[model samples]
Target: MNNLPIGFYVDNLYCFPVGPSGSQRFCYLPTTPRIEVLGNEVKARILNSDDAAVLALQIVWEADTDTIEKAKSEIKNRYPELSFINLSLADFRGVTATLNINKNDKVIYSIGPINTSGPDMFRAAFQDTLKSAEKEAVLNAFNTGESGVITIVYDGYLKLNEIADAEFDGDLATEIKALAPREVEEKGKGFFSKKHKILTPSPSLQECKDAVGKAIENKSLIIQHKDSANVSKKAKDTVIQEIINDISQCVFTKIEEVGKNSQYISSYCCRIKKTKAESVKFNLKKSYDLVGTISESRGRDIIEK
Candidate 1:
């Protein structure tokens, strides 16, 4: 029978007791990976090599070595705290002897660095060793435990798709062109001087929705004209208005929580477009106030909300 199965090797180097800290408050100190556990030690799972390094640093910021060496030491110090029973390549002796193994053979472990430049140089070397020892048919031989030279080869590939259909047709294009803006004469600067208006702040979310419903009911212009093609540009403008109306009709709920306090606010806007929606979401909670302006062209206005 094989001496080892599908399980990880564990080593405990150091540990300490901690209290009252968030995210598991315990501190253990060990210089190396495999120190014997004492009877009065804290309870935790084993740590994988990478996790061991991380945990060691979490417990104490400094390790007694440079990058790679520090990583190894940290791993050694905390390997016993991990829960998974993965076999360690470091613990296995014949791991170096038989480098040939099938990729699908269900090897007990995978080993790699925290980061690698380009392809991992260590993994590349390891793969080369496996190819040399296995020869070919690595997977089949590994699955059956057959006594023969095995070879494993893996091919990587990618796929792409080309666009086939265009959604904008002749009618849609003609309508869209009609919606383009035409310049009009500028308004007199003193036009609003006689009328003094109070700048009231926007209402809460519920009030905003009620106001939007009232405005839409009053406009009576939600539907686009089918025969608007005679005035192609006008028809396109109507379509754009329809799109804005559809967007404004959709309601979004907002909830904000601060420490022990929580509040819900609902709001709506009349002029909703793709660009405006993006800007609103991007600047949310920062700029809550809105303003409006009229266009020189007839029946054209821009509202920022």
Candidate 2:
């Protein structure tokens, strides 16, 4: 009987350099072939340790098992950073690859090594991998037709770009006034009085209003749902409250209230604010977020910087 057409499995691939600085010699570690091929199952192990850079990857396939061994072998030889050991074939359903890395280590899988060369090359390679993975994910999702709602909390502060684009309430007004400058005047001999001047258009207030209004207008629940009225009133209430909480938590990062339009600042701020706001909007509208984040920025410092 012919050996089952099995894919290749690489146990561990490692790269370490030797010789003097700037004239270093490097090659794969001396060890058992870290790669293995089993009927439909391929496995490999790899390690990346470089003074300046390192990478480790394990590639596997679910189709065309017969070509996996050849494919892996070719790839390994071309990329010295890769290693293939324990050449064997067996009966299995899938292949596996693993890399040993520190908790803080960042790993990237690319068609080629990233060098002093501009990210252009790396980006192209990265894109190919991403496209492949994305295609697979989208296909899987489409085939499974599985989706649901997810609720996310967003909280942060933003500066006013223009004024009055979004409505403002007392709570919002208070937060804005707290961040403004105060004027001092002398009253005769030793007595002095201070008056507070409203220097900028407070967009935070409007942000709150816009955020809440948007949720209401879209009939979106902060808690997240998939176009379902099956949600209990309590759940619905929770979602609304969470939306409010997120808006209220936002702090104005920058205030550009000088333009005659007054709205210019508010509009500009909203655009930037969307990074975090969009997540809330997504949860409210689609019942789930395919992308986005809700964490608030540290403060206005990031914006001003």
Candidate-wise lDDT, in order: 0.24, 0.27
User: Where is model 1 more than 4 Å wrong at Cα?
Assistant: 1-105, 109-205, 211-305
Model 2's TM-score against the true structure: 0.18
Q: Estimate, for each residue in 1-305, the C-alpha lDDT of model 2 and write its tens digit.
A: 01211122333322222221122222221112111234533222112122211111222212233444554465457445535333222222111122211112222222322221121111111112123333333223223432211111111111111111112222233333443333344344434755444434345555745654565466442232221211234544444555555544443433224322333222221111111111011010011121111111211111110
Q: lDDT tens digits, residues 113-221, model 1?
A: 1221111111112222123222233322323434322221211111111111111111112211222223334544695745443322223444434443454456532
**Model 2 accuracy (lDDT, Cα):** 0.27
> For residue 199, what is the lDDT in candidate 2?
36
Task: List all candidate RMSDs to the true structure.
Answer: 29.5, 27.3
Q: Assess the local accuracy of residue 114 in candidate 2 as a C-alpha lDDT between 0 and 100.
A: 20
The top-ranked prediction according to TM-score is 2
